[model samples]
Target: MSDVLKLEAPLGDVIRKSKLKAIKSIVSSFQPINNDKIEFKNNEHSDKNISLDKIQIVANRFITIKRLGSGGFGEVYLAKDKNQNDLLIAIKFENINTSRPQLSIEKYVFEIMYECSYIPKMFYFGIHNEYTVLAMDLLGPSVEDLLNFCGRKFSLKTICMIMEQILRGIEALHNHSLVHRDLKPDNFLFGLGMKSHIVHLIDFGLCKNYRHPLTYEHILYRTGKTLTGTARYCSLYTHHGLEQSRRDDIECLSYIIIYLAKGFLPWMSIKNSNRKKRNEKLMEIK
Candidate 1:
């Protein structure tokens, strides 16, 4: 038995070394983009003059490859880390001068939940030029994107597998005393490369600590609060202007699962130009 164990140990070591060598070779062969001549866009409408140099490289390491998407908070870009074997990363930029800044709060949440596997690995968070920047692991297409790709619906087996991971992710956040107020299909994204099947929960701009961090006591229920998340997937309690709890998160997840399976929610067609009336109609149908 001792002789057999010794042989197996050496064989395992050899296999690991071979894998490491292959990975290193692949990384070494990768061609990094030349960012010296890259042209970054500057918004002329902004009062602050954002220079071209400030928006090019972030943290003195990552180079912006291209803009991926933009929302009310800011824009997200595909960047490459020059210091880390030219590894691809996603960088979110929020204008420092914006009236409502949420990237800092998002950064704090990322720091607290860094150990959770379902959370994206935060690489860097700091000020770069006129924007507050956050760099993280580049994730693949979101569940919403996949839904469109799959002709607007997912199979039962696919939904089962996706929901299992999404539930685990929510459980992890709740265990940490946080509630993801903004739970939707767009925020749940698949991992890249070999981890394509792994689901990652993102967009913590609206997340909140639902309990006392140290004492673990839940927060007091409140009323007459403005809605904090997407109206479509939010719980009934949220629509009623009540504080969200762990149950609200689960309720939102249930709505998301139903949407994935059915390809559309009943209230999706509510298109009243007035936000208040639209929400009222949605509440009535919901």
Candidate 2:
């Protein structure tokens, strides 16, 4: 299996007529080295639900300090690296028994996106008993939190600064032929404490490469891609069940900028009991 998630793409006139050599030339403009191969280690332990207070990640002794969040996948904790002057890190724990692929896919994407500074720094992945754990640099509050704090809006200067950081992150992703289908204020987080001005893009569960590696050909566009991102910020193509491309990310970011400026989207109040109806209404509003 390929490291990139396999999704059906739509066929379009532009994609059909694209010259392979020209596509390869454009891809060559970026500086991504091919390192798609990833291998994960499994821990030989009996306990599946790893208790942070009782255990530590192997290789590097990252001691758990407190739980940050938890959901169906597992728990995320704020931990300290005992060997590194109690350096803070975020560790996510997932039961190895589950069939969910979030942990594996996330690790894969992190490895491919490692060179991008705007992306989060992944320290390592390990197993604690029967749980698979991923450790990363702890980031600070998201733009969503900042928007709420400022009464749902930002000053002109702050908005410009934030958008510049976001565009840089998106450019990095596109340079690697990857498209971040899901984009919103919650996914763009500022670094914590001393790294405050630096913004990091997180959450890769919905990320995928949009071009073939060997041929550098654009993936054919496809339909029936389920709603893969936040409803309020999703692109019109997404609402229409069309394949998302690089432009979709830019479009979603534009919506986010509008939200930062106007507090809320005009379609925020539109509601329909049926999900499809809601999405259609959103498209109409757009």
Candidate 3:
């Protein structure tokens, strides 16, 4: 319910004149996810909307296997690297207009924190047809899934372990001048199969750099901006339209820890209440 305004223009178009060149800035910054056997076949239908049956190749390297999930931005599919031992990866396809900013932002953030053990590695980012696609390491089930398996609550020992990893991830992110606007159970994943115990922070789609790129000065505060991130875990300052800072990330992390420890937040049941009533109830809970 924050009032931050979002412009309805392509980020590449707003920031630079040439869309391809602007996108190339990120593409040129990193190596391909798999370069051994890239084979982008010329398809007359490349620009058409993507479907599982319709997709054969992505960036000439990964082939679609099945749809994994879909969100407001686009669809994610499980893909296999054709040249590298058929390595499994997740390919997220988002239409240019709706996904450009998020894709670009995520790539930029990954460029900064790719070495962090708690963060997923971005294998590649590029445009196919009219969609901006990102290929990243396929991770395992989220902590939210783990919570469900444990009957909606985490034991103190489990919560402590998970929180420790999460704190490390947050520290790594902050060390690079980034703030994860959305830090929730669903965004933290356990490694798949052999790497199960390793927790990774995923989905940088809502992350932002709190410091200026060049000067490295902290971004100044702004008010009345539209709310970003999940309402349940958003910092109280977010409710007042204040810009998110490193502290907000920590605050949201605190809320998540509280939820994991208690099973449910005190305000969860009153989420549907009117704004005034909700605020009053939340204040009482505080």
Candidate 4:
């Protein structure tokens, strides 16, 4: 068994908060990115579908190896950088014609947070044929994947270590006045190779700036809006359609920690076939 699993109590009991605070501020420059200035051109041929089998090369550099996985945004592929001695990378493609395009915002977030420890490095962002493509550092399995591998639960010490990194990641974003609207186990992935122990926050498709970049003003709280994240892990405020702030992100993280430690959540077993009714039940139970 690993030493991390041998521990009985949470890591926070041993680590000093002051030391963690110092560590969290190690990444300098918390300047927020201006959302208004960034502009992405709509692909005129966006009506055409993206066929991965036909797309061997993207942006004339990375060569697609195979699809890694997919989500509501689009598909991710394992690729190699031919110009960089076949350096492996992950490329994500979002259909340009989707009702809600998120790749542009995701790319902008990566650009602004390039120096942050918990963020993946973005290499290329542009339109490829009919899809908006983003190439970045290829990461390893998600926490969800590892949780399943570990029989759906994590040791207390392991959970503490994971939450520490996750907290840092969320702190980095919150410091920049941004909120990751979608916070779930699937979006928290492990780094690759020697950095495998490090945790990275991914899938910023639903990320939003809760405060104005220039004025540093907080966004107004409103309700009766549609939910933005995975229903199981989203916070109560989010399920109720309120504008998400940093608190919602932290609330979702708390749910994630509990689920990792307990192997399941109370709302995970809801089986109402009607999606609307099921979400209503989830909100009630959650």
Model 1: runs farther than 4 Å from truth? 1-55
Model 4: residue 208 alpha-carbon error in angstroms:
0.8
TM-score of 3: 0.77
Model 3: weakest 10-residue lDDT segment is: 22-31
Local distance difference test, per candidate?
0.69, 0.66, 0.65, 0.70
Give the per-residue lDDT digits (tens) of candidate 1, residues 1-286: 2232234343222223223222111100000011112211111122233234334788789998766656445767778999899998877777788655666766776788888888888899999867887888887667776666556766676777779989999999999888877788878877766666678897665567788789998888888777667889988998897878899999998899889888899999989888778887888888
Runs of candidate 4 exceeding 4 Å displacement: 1-4, 7-49
Measured with C-alpha atoms, the lDDT of residue 242 in candidate 3 is: 81
lDDT of 2 by residue, 4-97 (tens): 1112222121122222221111000001122123211111122234456665555558887767665334667778877778888877787777
- Among these predictions, the greatest TM-score belongs to 4
Which parts of model 3 are misplaced by more than 4 Å?
Answer: 1-52, 271-286
Of candidates 3 and 2, the better by lDDT = 2
Which ranking of candidates, highest lDDT first? 4, 1, 2, 3
Model 2 regions lying over 4 Å from their true place? 1-60, 71-73
TM-scores of the candidates are 0.79, 0.78, 0.77, 0.82
